[model samples]
Target: MAVLTSWVWLLAGCLSAAVAEDSNVSALYPPLWEESPEQISDYRLEDGKHIMDPWVITDRMGMYRILLKQTAPYFASYAPENEQNILWGLPLQFGWQYTTGRLADPTGMTDCGYEAGDTLCVSVDSWWADVNYYLSVLPFLAAVDSGILGIPSDQISILPPLKDQMMFCYTVSGCQSAFPEAMGRWSAFFQYMQSPSSDFDGLLEYLWAAHTSSLEYPTRAFVDRYAYYSDQEANFEKNWAIAVDYIAATRLPTTLSRVHSFQNGLPPRVLVDTDIAPYIADFTPLQNKVLVLLNVLGNIHHFTGSLFLTAWESAMSTKAARKLFLISFEKFLETSS
Candidate 1:
């Protein structure tokens, strides 16, 4: 079965908080002003940047094949003139680092809430790390292919014809596809599966007019090239570096100053790839206690909001103070081993 990692923010395209629209933070750290609080259309962050525009895609099979365009940034554009070798915009600093020097990884860091195991390094920051997660939705796949890709509960074989029709130059004119034909061909494969009776055709007609696939950095190459400075690997280094130093010096969990981060770790580390067994033990007891308490409260129905908040806070404690995640990792089976 295809995995559909649906997120609350996917549908929360509108923003309710005025704070998001007016926040001076656009200078950039985290996007506290998420679309959830407001309609993304009202505050299209990528408006003229063209590169970040949300509507620049080509539909293939049941997927949106995104291509670069002249209006988009030179780095991500597929246009021959704007074609960047890397997927996303590569920063100049990492380019210099790759050519001019090699920075040594911290050989040792043993601290609660942080661990750099073997050659692989790991870091722990507060919710600041959540940005590492991507924003891919099945809806994206479905819209590109007339909602056929939205079927996550069943096994569907790859349709060869759809793939064949997908490869080509991307433009509003040529990029527009005959998703109706594709949808009709797929309808017979599943009884429960329903294709729109030309309603989706009209929707596709509308959707096909504007391309919408520039919201994310699509490839590892893009991340590697553009994120060299703050790549997850490097951020892991930074967070772990701070964590280790803080723990080693304080011999305890403490709120770390952000300034101490990432000096040695150029690219942030990727914990998603970490072996859970090696580091799961580092999760602190405080987090476990909170999660356990939340579980106790979850038995009741009314104080539910508190239960959710407790769970959320407990999960967010990836800082130097929680081993509650040992259970979390085991529950999620995120352990590398």
Candidate 2:
């Protein structure tokens, strides 16, 4: 009984440590960080155009930075410091991806995103970077179109990637033409953001609708890219994609604090073939268990239909209920084990 008590204490300590990590928010920023442009005037102008190259990691992040700054007024009434902005998740997640080397080329053929070559480079070969492009670049274009950026859509031009030029759309009109559903959804989100009636939950609903829609095409298009990564990384990518749908269905407001806490459960870096979760020194037992659960859920998602997800989405519709459900579920699983 004493030995069991000691183990319980250790587990509790580890969980406490994870919770404490939320205060170390600087870990969420990418390496070699610099202040990003908060407005269009900060960007370089080329022949009456605001020039942006979304292929660069910082440049891509700049888009989100600008977006949050522009949209802060809409969310100010909900909470102070723009902490209530649902859009915080996008830039925060992107920064986490970069800090963890998910933005690096996993193919080992290029040094794009490697500190030795070009630290700021966001490789087109990276599945994380490519999928993130849809999340970052598309919404940015839509913001311009919706007049949130205070610029005409055509006044801003995003540079294209080298190989997959045709896969991405550089201009608002081009994106609207190529990705009508995603563009429309994003435009609607901006419209709603500008609405006085938009509360936190309403913003979350609109934001997730647009966020999930933005992910649809890229997740399908980048299926082939997963082959370049390890089994663990590939599975993680799929799991994260499916998890978005689950979260979107809940309409949970992914505020800054909530997102930071939630990301603590995610793997800090791409898992290599040789890295065993149980023995990973940096991860606690709870984190290892979470990783294992992710793999199981990822596999189940692959082999099964959306019925389970639908049921889960229906059962836990609110953030408070979802939290209670998770706590109760964990307690049940622990007792059974």
Candidate 3:
């Protein structure tokens, strides 16, 4: 069975309340966002080929960092300091998953992602890591196909995770064959990236198309994986999945800084039954409410399908309006329920 992972995210790629900065926040980014070598010189050479292993969080993140560094020139005309590089969203989201322990083995039967075991290990047992593979490897291989990596496709080899090794494609041709739609969409993004006519909005459109496709395809495959997670976590995953469609429709910038900022409004770790809005002192009231609303929306039988996008776009088109709507929504839920 070619299964999937139950990755979760909420309020990403959209407007959200302000984030509370952590005291040890710098400790949260992936292992080497700042120091990871951007060039090919650092990769292990095997039989004259650069070996890439993404099963571990650090190495997987390194690929995105390297891609961002390599693609910086293409985006310089749009924004400064690689801020506009569409690839930034990939690593930033992955970093959050790492800090929040989403990349760890959720089952508790294994220490795959624990500091006491292999801290960098991205467990196959983790739904977040599994879904992330599509986001990571597909875009990565597409980058190589688009010639953004500046390396021959055959010159590099990607090592698979410890388990579910057969589920993913390792080479450019393999990925293209297995996931043509996502690979093609991502290839278009990179191609447009190098085009002289490329603009920020256009790049974002392409990026989001590919981003949502990557997410949507694996969701059905991983429906069975939800059994391993807590109800709160599973609900959050479904809610996050639903929310991304609306965000993609809006074509949000999805830059590194913007995503990093928006993600702070989300819960940093797996949600437990005890964690509830206005009751959890660690998170702001707004964050708590946002979390609560996501669960409500995800769990509500009446809120099925993609119908909300029409209303969401018409009524909450502006950031202030969306924020106000979400803030007011909790009250509505209170009154109605």
Give the candidate number with the greatest lDDT.
2
What stretches of model 3 exceed 4 Å from their correct place?
1-14, 17-31, 299-302, 310-337
Better-scoring candidate (lDDT), 1 or 2: 2
Show the lowest summed lDDT stretch of 10 residues, model 2. Answer: 11-20
lDDT of 2 by residue, 88-130 (tens): 7888788889888999888879889898988888989899999
lDDT of each: 0.23, 0.75, 0.72
Model 3 scores what on Cα lDDT? Answer: 0.72
lDDT of 3 by residue, 59-112 (tens): 788788778888889988766566667677788888888888888888888888
Best by TM-score: 2
Ranked by TM-score, the better of candidates 1 and 2 is 2
Q: TM-scores of the models, in the given order?
A: 0.19, 0.85, 0.83
Question: What lDDT does candidate 2 reach at residue 256?
Answer: 70
| Candidates in descending lDDT order | 2, 3, 1
Residue 129's lDDT in candidate 2? 92
- 206 Cα displacement, candidate 2 (Å): 0.8
